[model samples]
Target: MSHPALAFSEAEYRVRISRAREQLVARGMDALLCFAQESHYYLTGYDGGGYVFFQCLVLTAEEKPLTLLCRRPDVSQARDTSLIDEIRIWLNAEDTDPANQLRGILSDLGFAGGRVGIELDTYGLTGKNHAAIQAAMDGFCTLVDGSDIVSSLRLVKSETELDYIRKAAALADDAYDSALDTARAGVVDAEVTAAIMTTTLRGGGDVSPAGPLVNSGSRAIYGRGVGGPRPLDAQDLLILEYAGTFRRYNCCIERSISIGGPTEAQRKLHGLVRETLEEMQTAFRPGDTLGTVDDIHRRRLDAAGHAEHRFAACGYSLGATYRPSWMDVPPMIYSGNPLVLEPGMVFFPHVMVGDPETRLAMGLGNTVLVTETGCEVMSRHSLDLPVR
Candidate 1:
């Protein structure tokens, strides 16, 4: 049978795997059991929605073949998308113990008494499954948290990955245009959302993990609001935060639109947001610490007298992701984070300001790549609030 088309070449995956193996060896780990779908895809080109169930990819330092422990339903998925030749299926019976099955697989692969790395902080591994695995591996192997081992490798983007991200960014710009065109007086929030989705999909964008949040009126005050059936009024504020994906690589954009001419207060907030985003671009140069960029944002907001309206984190890493959230990796733009900026790292710096008392929300943000000198904004949408 033919294998599914891979997003990257076999050489690229080999480099990724080599980096991961090096990290594992440095940490004294003999093998890595990855539960996160991102890690699976990054390592073996496996792409599927079956990660909601229990699935794991076992990567060993030794020349033994890589193995995948997945449910029967994902067997074809693994065969089709992954380069892994050894696949094991676990039955979902009430009395069946898949953890023990996994333990057996490890033992058969000569990892019975080795230091095995496991992704302990992922949703892919539930509490029940973790407990079962721990019980099964007791005295047989030593399990250690290796979540950052693979995740840290994904922080920097390759040129091929950046090309996909650029395509996703173009789609995000189109989605923003659609949102602006659909968001007007008397239009229902759902209609606007449908338009955004249509534009995104029609433009060859993949499904995003988070949202195309189309919050209007008071709901806009909440940062995490979603689209609803409510119709927009003649004088309403609409906050739109959405993303576009290409081969699971995501580029997100957030902008606020005014149904009518924006009020003076709305304009002020929008202006401040725009200014903060511009400052962020200047602050995102290589060699700068994540904390320094965050400090710049906070200082600018405080200087503008909008400290009370600032968001907790100005931005976070972005990349190929599965459900739960689109945010990726570490170094979230927050105070005290010591992660230094590096080239090839992509992030979305969103300048969000909301006043609950006034029920006003205004935001402007864009996906950016940290470059040798400064940064390059991926999404090309205007920073100014679009007045519909």
Candidate 2:
């Protein structure tokens, strides 16, 4: 059978595994139960969505091989993609209790009564599964929340990871250009979404983990993408928030376009929105807290009389994230967040404003990388509001 290519070098995976083990030691953890797909991919080049099931990668602090507990469907997935060799498969029988099987794996690994770190703050660990895991491991081992362990390590980009993000940025730029070219009066919003996704894949990018959020008409004033697509009006507002993903690494960009020509209010609001993002860009520097940047966003938009129209948080960190979201949190750009800016960190801060009273919206944003000098806006696209 043909095997798939891994995203990073094995040496890189080794370094990541060593670092994770070191974190476990420092935290007084004897083992780490990695449930997030990002954790598996980061540590062992494993990239399967079998995490939707009860899958876990057991990594002990001692120098030993990693063990994966998963369903049979992912047995080949693990063997082909990851360095993990000790694979235990739980059957799909009606009485199959993978949580109990996991407890058995922990017992075999000599983790009984040991403090193990579990990645609970992830989609992989569902409430039901977590409860089951707790019941199964009762009195066997102590499980602590270690959600931040792998995420903290992933915050700063490695040289190779930065290369992938740069490529993703180019694809995002092309996606915006494609959306601008395809969006027009009477065009279906879904069609425009298709153009954006097509541009990404055509440019050798993976499908975005979250949205190419295409909100049109009054929906442009909203933050999320709706399920049904609507036709663009002769004169309407369309918000296109999208990402260019390569090897699961993402760089997101958002823009609000005037479908026909803008009203004076829209044109002026867009300028302020763009200016707000520019000011936020200047503030994204090393040693500055994320709260400072958000304070600037809030203060600027509020001074312009759009306080109620703006989002609570401006943006968030971006990386190799999975479904249901692309905005890597724990360092969200919100008021009072104390996460310090650092070089090699990437962020997406959208200056969004929507006037529900006037039914108008204006937004501009891009993915940026923190640099030694300051921050570098990653997109080649202009922040200027596009007029279709």
- Pick out the ten consecutive residues of candidate 1 with the lowest summed lDDT: 221-230
Give one digit per residue, the lDDT tens place, for model 2 in 1-388.
2335678888888899999899999999999999998889888888788988889999889888799999888988788988885999988888989999889988888889999999998988899999999999999889899999999999999999999999999999888888888999999999999999999999999988887899988888888888997999999889888889999899999888888899998888888988889999998899988888889999998998888999999999999988878877778899999888899999999888888887889778888899998999998878886788
Candidate 1 lDDT tens digits, 16-89: 98889888889999999899999998988999877788788899876568899888888887888878869998
Predicted structure with the largest lDDT when compared to the true one: 2
Question: After TM-score superposition, what is the CA distance of residue 372 in candidate 1 from its true location, in Å?
Answer: 1.5
lDDT score at residue 366, model 1, on the 0-100 scale: 91
Model 2, CA-based lDDT: 0.89
